[model samples]
Target: MRYKGVRFCVFTLTVFKFVNGYLMTKSPPRYVDDYDNSVHSKGKFLCLFLGICSLSYHQVSTARPGLDLVYQWKQLEFDYQSEYDRQADIDMEIFIPGQPAPIDTDVYYAANSKESKVFVTIPRFQSGIPLTLGTVTDKMYKGNPVIAPYPSWSWHRSPKTCATERIVSVYRVMGQPVHSYEIPSRLLEPRSILVTPVIDIRDKQCEDTFVYIADCQTYSIIVHNAREGTFWKASDKTMYPYPNYGTFNIDGDSFDLMDGVLGMAVEPYSPGKDRRLFYHAMSSPTENFVYTSDLRNQSIFMHDPESSPHLFHVQDAVKEVMDGILPKKSRKIYEAQYDTFVKWCCQRKLENVNEDVLLVFFAEKSKTLSSSTLWAHYSMLKTMLNVKRNIDVSKFYKLSAFLKRKSEGYKPKKAKVLSLDQIDKFLLEAPDKDFLMVKTYRGERRTQSAAEAIDKNGVMYYGLMSDMKIACWNTKGEYGDRLYSDIVASDSVTLQFASGVKVVKNLKGAQELWIMTSRFQKVATDTLSSSETNFRIVAGKVDDLLFGTSCKGKKHITGGTAGGGYGLISTPRG
Candidate 1:
C-alpha cells in the first residue's frame, strides 16, 4: 500500500510539470536573443530564475533580499526614463488644482527600505512590467504618502512670475486628497511658504506651522510698485482694490516699509519658551524676527496677516548690531570703498537660545570679490534668526556711501613684496600637489611676442618679444640640454606644428614647410611638402595687439591693428 501511494504521487507531479512545460514552450520567446551576450541578458535571466523560485516558495519565504531590490530598482530607472520622456508634455500640463495626478509624482516621496522590497517582489507576480510600483500608487500605506519626489502641486507655480494656484491642499499616502483651503484674495498672495518643525509654542505643542511671505514687485517681478502694480506704502495705506506690496526702490530712498523678503528660517529647538521666526528683505540690509505663537493664530492670520502686530521686532542681540558682523577683512582689502558695504546681521539660535548662533554675512556691495565677503556673508546667515531689533537699512546704506566717498581720496599703503625665501616656502607648502611654478626671464625689454605653444612630450615653443625668434624649452621648462632656439627668416612670422609637419607662414609673403621632430622642434626642410596649401587671412591695423594663453587653456593670438584678428594654437598629442 505504501509503494502504491508513492508511485501515484510521483506520477501526479510528472504530469503537472509536463502540462506547464507544454504551455510555456508553445508561446514565442518574450525576451529577444539580440541581448544574449550583453550584461542585461544575465540580469534578465537572474531575475527570471528568482521570480520562478519566488513563485514556488512565496508562501514559505515572506522576506526579499535587499540586493535583489536594488537590482530591480536599477532596471526600473532605465524603463521609467522612456516612459517619462514620452509623457513629458502631458505631465507638465497636469499640475492644475483638482486634476488627475501624474504617474511620476512618487518621485518626490522619501525612500523607504520597506517600499524598496515591494518594488522588487510585487512585479514578479504581475503579468507585465509595473508602470507604478515601489511608488505611492501602492495604496497599502498611509500618512503623507512619502512626500512625492516631484510634488505635482509644485508645477502650478512659476517662481519667475510668482504666479501659483490660489488653493492650498494636503494629501495622505497614495495620492489620497485630504483637506484643501482656498486662500482669500484680500490677503497678500504667497510668493513662498516656509514651515517650522513641530515645537512647543503658545503653551501648546504646536505642530509644524506654515509661514507665508508676499510676492512683491522686486527681484522676480523686476519692476517698481507704481509701474508693475499696486503696492502698500506707509504714506498711503488706504485700502486699494488690491492688497499692498513691499517696495525696495533704493534710488528714491523709499525702503522704510517691508519691501521684498527673500531669506527665511525657523528655530527648531529654542531655549526660550517661545519659538522664533526670522526673515530679511532683499531690498534692505535689515533683519527682523517674530514669535511663532503670535503668527500661528488662525484668527489673527485670517483677518490681518500682513500687519504683523507687536509680535514683530527688529534684530538686536548682545548690543552687537550689524557692524559687528560685517567683514573686517574687507575694510583692509577695499581700503577706499570698504565703508560702502551694506551691513546687517540676521541672527538665529537653533540648538539653544544662546548655543548654536547663526549669523548672516554682510556684503560690501552687490559684487563679492574676496573670501572676506563670503566669510562675512555665511557667518551672518548662521546668526540671522535670533536678531531682536529692527534696523534702518536705507539710512545705513546711505551713510555708508557718504563715508566711502569721504575716504576715497586717502590712498592705502602699498602691499609689501614677498622675499625669495618667503615665496619658496609658500610654494613648498602649497595645497595643490600638481602645481609647479615656472618663471620666464625676458632680458629687460619685454618684446612684442605674438604667442606660445606646448606639446605632449613637455616641449614648449614661444616667440621672444618678436615673432621671428622661435625658442624651445625642455621638460623642466628651462633652456637646458634639449633647448633649441632659432631665428626663422620671415617678414611676418607665424608657425604651426601639426600632422607630422611644421608650417611657417609669413603674413607678408608665402608659406614654408619644415620637417618637425616628434618633440615639436622645427627642423629646416630643403623642399616644400606637396601637402602645403595657400592660407591667407586679412586682419586689423592695431599696433598694440596682444597674444597669450587664456585662463581656459586656449591661446589668444591676435594680429594687425584696430580690427584685430584672433587665432589659437594647441599642442598635439604624440
Candidate 2:
C-alpha cells in the first residue's frame, strides 16, 4: 500500500485516460481500447516517487510560499489481537504468509472524529501480507487490539483469476489537488528576508497572544506578536548551551546527548497576572525563564507604535543609564559594597549617607581588606551612590587622594588564559619524562561553590549545574565538559541537584567518580518545597566510564628524574 495520489485534474489523465485534460492536453481519451493499460502503468510509475496523498477536507491553495505540514496526532499500531487475526487468516489459507514478517510500510488514522479505528499498511513487498489496508479495531481479543479487513472481509475473499471484489492494492485514500501542499509562493517570495530556521513554536496566550519561536540554527529566541503579525529576536540567548560544555558521565558512560532548544513551556497565570515562559537547550542541564510581559514589550524589530516615547522623568532615565554602565557580575558586587556601607551607617545611628559616612566606611574596610580592595569599593560606590542616591562619591577629593596615595607603589596582577592551540602544543611537545609535577598547582584565583574532587593525575573533577555534569580539568582550566546529565539532574523538578563531587579511591587504589547533589538553587530562590534529605550521591568508577573521559590515562606523563616546574592548575606566580 503506497500513499500516492494523483491530483483531481490528473485523475482524468491517469484513471479516465483523458489526454486533453490538465496534463498534456490532446484529444480527450487519447488512449484507444487496450492503450488504457499502458497509460495507467505510466501514471502509476509517475506517482510512485513524487509523493502526494490528500487527506485534507478542502483543496489547499498552492499560491503561498514555503512548506506547510499537517500535525500528526498519533502513530497507528496494531494491538496483539489484530496480529492473531492475521495469523488466523493465514491458518485458514484465506491469506498467504509473507516470506519475511510483514513490514508496516505506512500508517494512517481514520479521519472520522468518532471512529476508533487505526489503519496500518503492509505493502505486498513479498507474498505473505494478507491485505493491503486493514483497520486495527477498537475490539480487543485477550486484552489486545485486533486487525480486520477495511470495508469488509468480502473485498479480500475473491480469487485472483476473475476477482473484482478482491482487495488488491491501494495507492491513496483521498482525492488530491495539484501541488496543494508543496512549497508556498509567499515563503519563497521573501527568501532573502528570512535567515533563521524555525525549530520550535510555543504560544503565550494572553489578551494579546504572542508566539515564542526558538531558532536553534542561529542560537536565537524569537517572539512573534500574533495580534500584530510581527516578530523580533529576543533574550540575547544567555541561557543557550555553552560551547565545549554538555557531555556527562553517568555510571562512567559518556554521552554527548542532544543539542539546541528542544524543551519549552509557558507557565499558567491568572487573568490579570503576568505569566512566565520556561525553556532550555535539550543538551543543557539548566533552565532559563523570562516573563511573558517582557516578551510583549517588543524591540525595534517588531513594534514601534509610539516610535519614540519621551523620557518624562529625567532622573529615572539617568538612573537606567548609570545602571547600564555596570557589568553583569559587577552589579551584585557593587550592591554588596553599598549594602555594607548602609549597615555600617545603621550601626552608628547615622541616617544620611554623605562624605563623612563614606570616609569612615572606607577607613574601616582599608584596615582589614587590601588597599586595592578599598579602591574597588571606592570605584563601585562612586557609581552605586550616584545611581541609587544621586550622590557623587567621586567629588570627595580628599578621600580619593588618601586611597590613591596608599596604592601609589602597588601593581595589580592581571589574569592570563593560554589559547587552546598553545595549550595543546605544550601538552604534546612537552614530555612527561623531562618534566615532573611534584607539587599541587596553586595559582588558581577563580572560585565556584561546587565542592571538587582531585584525581590521581592532579586533574580536579567537579559537578556543574543541575544536569549532574561531572567535569574535570588539569589545572589550567583545560576542561569544562561534563560526564553525565539527565532528568535526575534537572534543577526545577528534582531536589537532588548536582552540587559537590569527589574522586574516591578504594583500598585497591581504584578511583571512582562520586558526586553529592543538593537543592542549592531552591534555597537561593526561596522556592524550597520540601525538607527531606537534601543530598544525593552518584558514584561510578573511572576505568569503567566511556566517551574517553581521560579519567584513567597517564596524560603524556611518564616517570621523570629531573626537577620540573611547579605543576598547578593555576597560572605561574611569576
Candidate 3:
C-alpha cells in the first residue's frame, strides 16, 4: 500500500521480503547473492532492520529542540524594617498587670533624629468617673526598678529587674492602672513589677539565734542576739545597756560592752567554760588596743599596763561584757588582748593558773598577728621567769639559741672525716664530679675540679698547696721539694701518708702518739691507713703503749708509739 502521492512496491519471498513505502524505498534480498546458509540468517536480518529504524526515530525526536524549562525553590521574605516603621506610628496603650484600665500617656522618642511620638488615649468608663493617673514615683533601668521608699521620695533600684529609669508610680485609688510614657533607650524596656515586703525583726522572737550585719565600707560590726540588743558605736563609749556585765578598759578609754548593733546579736558562752569576749578597739586615729571581758566572773581585766601600754591582754574578761552580744571588731581586739595576757601570764609563771589555759591562749592567738608578738613576749617572759625561779630553763635556752642562730645566718657544720672503708664505699656508689681528683702511687693522676666522688686510698699525697701541688717534706718539718713532679694535682688532696710514727704511754696509763706525716690534706683527720703491706703491732710487745686495768686512767695518757707497714692494723693493749 502507498499513501501521500507516493507509490508503494511490495515483494515477498520465502527467504526474503521487501516493502517500499512513500517515506523510503525498500530493497529485497537476493537469495543467491546475499542470503546466508545459516539457520538464523533471516532472524538476524529482521533484527538489524528493526534496530536501524529505532535509532533513526530516536535521533529525529532528540534533534527537534523546543523551549527549555527550569525550576528552583526559594524562601519567602517580608520587610521587617518597614513593619517596624509602621508599628512605630501606632500608639499602643501600656497597662500594668492586676490593674483596672489603661491610663492616658504621652510617648517620647529617644534623642535620635527620628520624630517619633504616639498619643495613647484611655477610654472613659460608662459610670462617668474621672480618671486620675497614678503618681509617677521614679525611673528604673534594666532589671533594677527605681523604687521610692519615702512618701515624697528617694529612688532605689529594684533588685529583681534589669531596667533603667523605671517610673515607679503609686495610685490614689487602690490597684489603679499603671502605664509607661515612652521607651527611651534600649535599656528602658518594661519587663515586670516587684513589690518588696516589709520586715520587722523586733516583732518576732528569734531564740538562741544570733544575727550579724557589717558595714563593709566602714568595717563596723553589728551583732544582735535573741534576748536583747546592744549597739557598740564606732566611738570609744559603748552605748545602749542590756543586763549586768563587765567592762574592760582599752587604752584607758574605749570600753567594749555587749550590745547588738543593727539586727545582729552576740551570744555569750556558758559559764565556767573560760569563755571571754575580746575586742580590738581602734582608739583615736591610729591607736589600737585589745580589751578582754570575762562573762562568767562578770569582771574585765586588761593586759599589764607597764609591759604594754599600747597593748593590753585580758583573759576571759571580754565574755562578761559582750556575752549574748554580737561580736564586733572591738570584741575581736579584746579577745586578742585576753589571749595575749593569758599567754604572758602562763609563760612568765607569774600566776599559778592551769597550763591548759596557756595552751588554749596560744592556740587561739596563733590565729592572729598578736601571735607573733605573744611569742616574742613569751620568750622574754620565760627568760625572766627562769632567772627569778633559779631554774635551768635549758629548753627555753635552746629555743632562743635556735632563733638566734636563724637570725644570724645558717652555717652548715663541718663535714666529718670518713674512714678508708667508708670512702671506698662512697666512691663506689657516688657519681663523679668535675671538682674531684684521684691519684695513684704509680704517678698516674686524674684531677676533676668539681668531681662528685674521689678515690684517694691508692695514692700517697705529699703536701697540698694552693695550686694543688704535691710537695715533699724534709726532716726539718718543712716542705722541701715537689714530689711526683709535673703530675696532675688538686688544690685539696684527700689522702696523706705518715711514716715512722711513735706511740708512748705516759704515767697516767694513757697512750699518746705523735704522728709525723709527709703530707696533710684536710686539717682534721679521724682515720689513718696504709696502702700496702699488712703488719700488726702486738699489744704486749710495747708495755708503755699498754694501759693499766682501769679504763679511766688510760684517758690521761699523752703519748704512744706503734710500728706498722702499708696497712692499718689496730691492736688494743690491756
**Which one wins on lDDT?**
2
Q: Number of backbone collisions per candidate, in order? A: 46, 21, 87
Per-candidate RMSD, Å:
30.6, 27.5, 51.1
Candidate 1, residues 328-390, lDDT tens digits: the string is 553233322211221221122121222111112232432444444444333232223222212
lDDT of 3 by residue, 225-336 (tens): 3233321212122212222221212111212223211111111233222221222111110111122122111111122112222212221122222222324553344345
How far residue 263's Cα lies from its native spot in candidate 1, in Å, is: 2.3
Candidate 2: lDDT over CA atoms? 0.35
Lowest-scoring 10 consecutive residues by lDDT in candidate 2? 24-33
Report how far residue 218 has shifted in candidate 2, in Å.
2.6
Candidate 3 stretches greater than 4 Å from native = 1-237, 241-354, 359-377, 380-574
Q: lDDT score of model 3? A: 0.21
Q: Model 2, which residues run further than 4 Å from truth? A: 1-207, 243-245, 248-254, 300-574
lDDT values of the candidates? 0.22, 0.35, 0.21
Error in Å for residue 365 of model 2? 48
Q: In model 1, which regions exceed 4 Å deviation?
A: 1-111, 114-177, 188-259, 270-272, 297-310, 314-574
